[model samples]
Target: MEYADSKCNAYDTYASEAKLYPCLPPVVVPSAPELIRVEGSAQSYRLQKINEIQKEIATERDKHANLSKKYHRAVRIVAGVDNALVVSSMVLDATGIGVLSTIIAVAIATEGAAFG
Candidate 1:
């Protein structure tokens, strides 16, 4: 009982609690409130909003397709004009990176490539 503080401190703090009576957990009962949401076709409204978003996405897709077509056409024209450049820098010299770089550069330069 009268052990030195250093020797007693070496044992775990919970040893006292373990020797004593165990603590009991309190029971909890959750109350359910009257979940009445003032709904007059809320799902329809959400659907309408979703449809609008889808339409916007479709419009964006169309714009992207058109822009891609125009970009492809421009790249084709640029490549044709600079066929010698492409040839000298690419396949003829066994380097495809130059051709890919030209395509990317043309798209970036013309598109302004700045999202914004």
Candidate 2:
């Protein structure tokens, strides 16, 4: 029988034995303590990364909360101003002063200028 050696060349083994058993090269394995140390280091690294990510998430949540508050406040202010405008417009229309027509003409002119 013939088998490939470490150099990958096939050689006959039948002269010494009728049967040949395939064997693999010996492998060097780490000791238990070495393996534990490596695993511990990896676990610590992962935990550290997790903590950093959690902090970043917290920061972003705070930013989002602040932005949401500001947005709501602006919406409320705009709504109040719109209500005031409606009341004023009604008062002007009821007074028979021709101010509403003037305001409408000005608004139309401003709109045309802005859009064009």
The model with the greatest TM-score is 2
Name the weakest run of 10 consecutive residues (lDDT summed) in model 2: 1-10
Candidate 1, residues 17-85, lDDT tens digits: the string is 333323345779889988787576997899899999999999999999999999999999998979878
Output the TM-score of candidate 1.
0.44
Model 2: CA > 4 A from native: 1-38, 97-116
Instruction: Give the local distance difference test score of model 1.
Output: 0.75
RMSD of each: 20.7, 14.0
List model 2 lDDT by residue over 1-116, tens digit each. Answer: 34454343234455564324434578899867544345888989999999999999999999999999999999999999999999999987787557777798899999999999
Q: Work out candidate 2's RMSD over C-alphas.
A: 14.0
lDDT of 2 at 107: 100
Please list the C-alpha lDDT of all candidates, in the order they appear: 0.75, 0.80
Clashing residue pair totals per candidate (backbone < 3 A): 0, 0
Off by over 4 Å in 1: 1-10, 13-38, 84-116
Q: Quote the positional error of residue 40 for candidate 1 in Å.
A: 3.7
